[model samples]
Target chain A: MNKHKITGFQYFTVFFFLLNSFIPFLGFHKITMISNQDALFSIIIGSILMIGFTFLIKRLYFYLPNKTLFEKIKFLFPKGFFFILGILFLLSSCILLFVTQEFTSFIHFYLLPEVHQFLITLPFLLLIFYFLRKEQEVIFRTSEICFYFYILFFIISMFGILPQSNFLKIKPLFSTSISSILRSSLYFFLSFPLPLFLLLYFPKNSLKRKEGGQKTWIKSILFSGIFLFVTLFLILSSLGVQLTNLYKNPLMVTYQKISFLNILERVEATLSFSYVLLYFFPMVLLIYLLKELILYAFSLSPNYEDLVLLLLLIGNLLGNQFFSFHTNFYFSISIFLAVFLIFLSFYSFLKKE
Target chain B: MKKTKLLFIFTLLLLFTGCSSYTELNKLGIVSLLGIDYKDEEYHLYINVVEGEQDDGSLQKEYITYDATGESIDEALHFLYLKSNKKIYLSHMDVLVLSEDVINSKLQEIINYLLNHPEIRNNFELVELSSPMNILFEEKIDSKEISDLIQMNQEYMGTSFSVTFEHFLEDILIDKNSYLPLISFDKNLEINGISLLKNLKILDTLSTEETVLFNLLQNNINQAIYKNTTIVKNETNIEIKKNQITFHLKTEINKNSNKFKENLQKDLRKILIYYQDQDYDLLKLKYKMKQNHLSSLEDSNVLFPKTSLKFDIKISYTNSYLERRISK
Candidate 1:
């Protein structure tokens, strides 16, 4: 299979991957810390701000057809500049993979206490590794399948959770200080849609006719935005502000509470399975991007599966080893890396032909 | 074709086969009910483990109560784990009974343990135990029945309301004032009333009548019969069907209808206002406040009696009940 072009649904699958990876993991605690009751408002504002950036990336994507932005950097920029940018991109992807592994470790801590962290993550990493090696269509199709599972879990969450929510917990809305709202909104802009920047690396022409257009960005943003909004609102209303801050993973906390008539207990374990399944797509995509970056940086041959394997193994080991030290600057570093990628995207678009 | 065949087998093996350790059922101590009592600066943990099997190819549940004491609930559980030959599993735990002493000063400690333990499911119903642990855990008394009683109270009883660990956590996070259905042992188990807790300490308890009123304020009452006085005592059966209330009042007095309803409202209002003045928001009235009342959340340190609740009294006299009373 030539395995180049992906349909609009596949493109949306990428959006779902980005959405599932971040919402409950990254934004839950940070939003509560910054805005408290004003979180939903701040998220809306932050999403609007992020959509503006995605629009700019869309403009840049169409600027040069049949070429990935990374390829554009290689073709247009000087050799030294391309080499440095490629290495930086690979480093950022590794950092992100490590950060995601920290959340995986949490799942181990809470759900699989009897199992070793390595054992918990090993199968997950291996599955993603297999996904990374498949034809692009297979990867896309698999993600499209997992997208349905995500929707199923999402519906379960809605029916399982919404009635239990105390709407009064969302009181004093729009009452947070201006500084707090702004700070949270800024946090949202920095973390979310940053990972979406990785989509820029996919060969633009790989998108089938009618894919990778204005509608793609709009649909991606709308789906992700509505999902984020509902999930965040449910967390805030269900857990409230104080308890939201108390749990490291409030979404998991909310999931564990999904019992109807005392029979539907332990749904978190099931939902966690869905979450880990959905997370594989983005993780594999990031690893694939990192491998390509490394190849482009070193002028290596295409047959470098060993290199991807080496990178993933070393990344997983280091992620588990330096777990505690990574927590302090995890968000800040992600934001910085995202901002850097955006800058590169804009520079490629703006440079004289 | 050869490559595709190999890949298919590989994927199937990975997907369907084993990756981690799996424990057999007989090798685990499955806890069905847990009781915590704090005394003399130490935490006492009691667990009711369901044990044994039958020859009928079915498992027979035998409640075996085990007790352990330590500096913390975690330490206590650690001791329990070590003492047992089988690994203790709490996933099937249905009820958590906390002694009054445990509720008073050790609630924070208990909550911390509950939050940390992955084995402890959040659906456990919490109740108060005034009886000694030894008596409560006696082999004669079925420990499992207590949890069933709690379920009954939550689903059917009108005079009390039950709080799950999830609800308690949510309430504590929001206001630190909440209520739990109280179960007491007086030779036999009984749903006493509801305990009003502030900052996890038992501030006071509502009588059975008061709990019904509390349920009314919370809109949690399904069907309840309440007796209150208005120059004469009347037993009224109240049922809330689809947001509308239908009450059958049986009064034996030739009293003015408006005054009788007014007295009922007065009694309800008095209890609510009294609790509000004490800053024990048992009804979560603060939670029900609109956006304009948000200032109360910020100035929570200052105790201001909530006076926003209004009562509109409507009465319908049933001809049959009226005639029966008149004949009497």
Candidate 2:
């Protein structure tokens, strides 16, 4: 096995992009639909709850300092560990398929309207397979390099979009019911930071400096939460509640309105390409997570890595073709996965492995 | 190893060619303007395409117009596509004109088509056309000329306003009402006024003078002439109470400030009452009341026409330097 560990900053970038990749495409639309004008408040409350849950995960990490989540499960429930692994394996596969479908649909709608869907999906799957052939450290390093470009384009797009926003569009605050806001907050909690639980596949000792891993985790969650909050606020203000709810991709439509100095018009595609960059890291990481899950379940050695990756590539292609999943389906599965992971963490804590 | 390297290079070259969606620029008919008209169960479509050619080692640009008619907009576009040698491209279209009939009967269908079409952008200027075929077929007048006319008039006279597809849709969705600038060809193409719309249908056309007043009430004026007095700035605010709505209009004028202020206040009141009598919430008073949380009635439509009106008009003299009149 390749022996390479990641730095605290690499871990930070990986978790940051992982938590934020879904906001522009899926999270913002669902949250806005549920809470209407009160989506901003939902994001805020959701961030607080996410931070609290991160603390619980941080506490669980102390019980087994250098053990991956799979190892801990094996140690805690030796008899029923395979059953738990089976559930995780199914959940990860489902998420992988859903994300692949969404990415393909986004590419079809925005970038390549005339291209066939399978052609669009084939290249991405091959890319994932190519990347999976390497050690997991490559994914983190890739995120570190892409993070700077992501920030630069993000700031430029914000400058283009901020001036055109009308604050009056967000008027009549507190119009939605308290229950609706809380329910939307729960959706936000489940959709955004809950995916960070997947990072437990990399144990604490995977970092070169293990002293401040928790601090890094909290920082990434905060940064991602603030990013989501600002995006929702801008979308609501620029495209009022009615228009925001009308379009399927409100953020991209809002990006269509970005005009800088009237000379830099029609740069929406260039700006929105940053979303593709943000989405790539999480996708690669999820594939890596699935690879680890399969190896642990089947008790296979590292020699079978290439074969496993090839099988996964074919599986993703077939899954995307045969299944038509909606955003709500993905959200429901995410909630289920988060609950299962939470139960696993508590079981490990009780057993104190 | 050499053969493997060559195969990899060939595969990379294939990827660089843009795969299945690739098309040559010469094969596209770039549309810069589109016009729609409905008559006798047929939809008429007019398009202006930008064509370029090389003449004596220099490229020259030309604007061409094509017309087609069918039972539906898509069918009309399909026929146009068949007529043209190149594929129709609409991403760069600048202006879309609709006749009064199209605005009256086919707006919802048009909106659904525009929203569903992927190649259409929302930045194009929208206008209502009078004698659309006459103006559309005028070879000398292209999209640039039409866009420039509306923009220049908006900046200089304030008799017209430029409405984009995005804002038009938003207004309809939020308030169920909107307006489009009216363009007509009388001797030449001229922006006459604005056409008022309610629930996706044209209700009436406001005269140039009434359009200036409407712009004033909505605080969308840069410079306009009201009663021969030049208005340079306008700041309007609407406040809603239990049983009344108040308009706080602050204006800056260049000349004849006092007389212009009185005339403007009188005309403003007359126009408000006129619209109120017509039961047309021209100023979006119903939306404003709901936005301000001032409407207690479950059905706010009943309260809109019955509410009392109040006006506070403030005028400041901008052209008078040193507090002394230069003329008069």
Candidate 3:
């Protein structure tokens, strides 16, 4: 009885928003800041795979009609299956913590490096927590408010990054194999828009089988592909493949190199702030997923999203010291495990279907 | 439940207040620009302290130079702090200026200090002050803030490059060598510098031209206006065309093991030449002449134009459109 209509532009904008989650966090899109990792090459190819896999995932979901992907896992596998998957998702949250910390540290160093780093992150985390405590309507409204600025940023990032790009270095594009690209795509998918799909908590029935519903997924993926290309191209052109590899933070160097005249330089603040607004959407989604997982596991449907925020506050503090980013991408969940997750989706859905 | 939640909120507020505010923005005294020079076995610290300078609205910042000596930069800074009216914080410090004495005598200590500071953001513009450190502080750059103008040099114009604090970390941490954009002030008090640092260690500065060449070779060409690109056809007037490169890398053949030996080298060379379209005189021929080490070729042909040169040259009217295409 209701339609949430999103245009091609909205679809494209959402893709940028999805990638934006990766951008603001310091190490998530580390390819742009430092291109040395074997994982860096994946940005280009991974983007393509993410697009391809989205379609396949959707088709697979159709076959297991009645259940959400997570539920299918609980039905199909033994008792501990969903719990293990929940832990994997928790690891993803840890990686996100590293990324957010890295980014905030970067912003503090660039914009107000003299201020205690804790001061910088404190404001951000507090703001994020305050929103997390609120209702979904407020969060969605906030995303709507921020999305306008995100579009403006995407346009500016393209222009700002374009002139500085060196097309020549785009050579040897396939320096990394197709496998590397797929791995990078997995990195994007594990923590991003896919995880955000846990927002299916509404009383409304299944996502419509209509074309528009399918477009939501397809359009977002396409938008991400274009974003990935631009980011890779910008980093490659600005830092050069060699030097880009050397710097731990390549985007910082790229921004340093960007000068309109001479007066308007050292804009790391503008970049970091813009990204904060953008990353908030996914931050909302992150908390939302945590809430859904706990609720679905116990079947306590009494609206505990706010309570989830409180848990995150404690978890967020403990998580600060839980893991170091050195292990971020070096350790990936295995292929067999990934397949098991896919299987869980099928079984969880079978009973419901 | 409401009473318990209120108590928890009150406790959190107490905990926050109990902890020290990490670093105070103004009281900590953000060192927006830093100048270090070795003077008479003593180290001098010149701080472009960014603050509301005077009652006058015209000048917004007061750049102060503090001179002190010790076994370490921190010690010297401590001595300077005792003399100064405010605290000296180097976290927001953007431009690190090394006087010729410090840079020449070896910048190992200064570089080490910067590397260790947690607050310094690594990618900062390492500059060389032409007129002694004191003179640099004296020059009134027309701007609201001294730091503001310093950024203008790098941000608005391709004139000066900044080696950010983070960039310094990258270069210093790298295995091989690192390069940084150098900053220099003219007699008229204008500042400029773009040079490379090899492995985060060096006093050697590349001229602006050499920096351009290095950028081109590395393919970091954001914008380039070659002074005079002279085609060596007849050594007359040379019309400049687009110059670009594509890279081809081998699978790191180990020479010690000597697996393919001759065949690999030959195969790799063929790939490189083929990828670049070596038949083109501008691309391969120029590189060849350089390889043969022609002394005459070193001469600037485009500027003097009348020098007789015997070399095959080609030019095609590829529109200079990198910037144009990006804009559209």
Docking class of 3: incorrect
Can you write out model 1's per-residue Cα lDDT over B186-238, one digit (the tens) per residue? 67888878888898799998887787666655656545555532222235444
Runs in model 2 lying further than 4 Å from the true structure: A1-4, A211-213, B1-19, B54-58, B138-140, B240-242, B254-259, B296-302, B317-328
All candidates' TM-scores? 0.85, 0.92, 0.62
Clashes, model 3: 38
Give the clashing pairs for model 2: none
Distance from true position, residue B153, model 1, in Å? 5.0
Reproduced native contacts, each prediction: 0.37, 0.42, 0.03
Task: Sort candidate 2 into its docking category.
Answer: acceptable
Candidate 3, residues A144-237, lDDT tens digits: the string is 5677776676566666767767675554344444565565656655444333243322211243334223456556656665665566567766
Clashing pairs in 1: none
For B254-309, candidate 2 gives per-residue lDDT tens digits of: 87555777787889899889888988888888877777777632446888888999
lDDT of 2 by residue, A241-308 (tens): 88888887887887888988988887878887778875677678778888888998898999988788
B193-251: candidate 3 lDDT, tens digit per residue: 45434433353554554443333333343443333331111111222222322232212
Please identify which of the two predictions, 2 or 3, would achieve the higher TM-score against the true structure. Answer: 2
lDDT of 1 by residue, A1-353 (tens): 24346888888877667655665346478777878888887778877877787766665576566776566776667666676675667565555555567656676666777776666666566666666666656777777888888888889887888877988677768777889998888777665544566676776678787676657766776687778789888987887778887777888888877887878776787887666754565666777777667776667876786566567656765666564435436466656666666676677676754
Higher-scoring candidate on DockQ, 1 or 3: 1
- What is the lDDT, from 0 to 100, of the residue B142 in candidate 3? 26
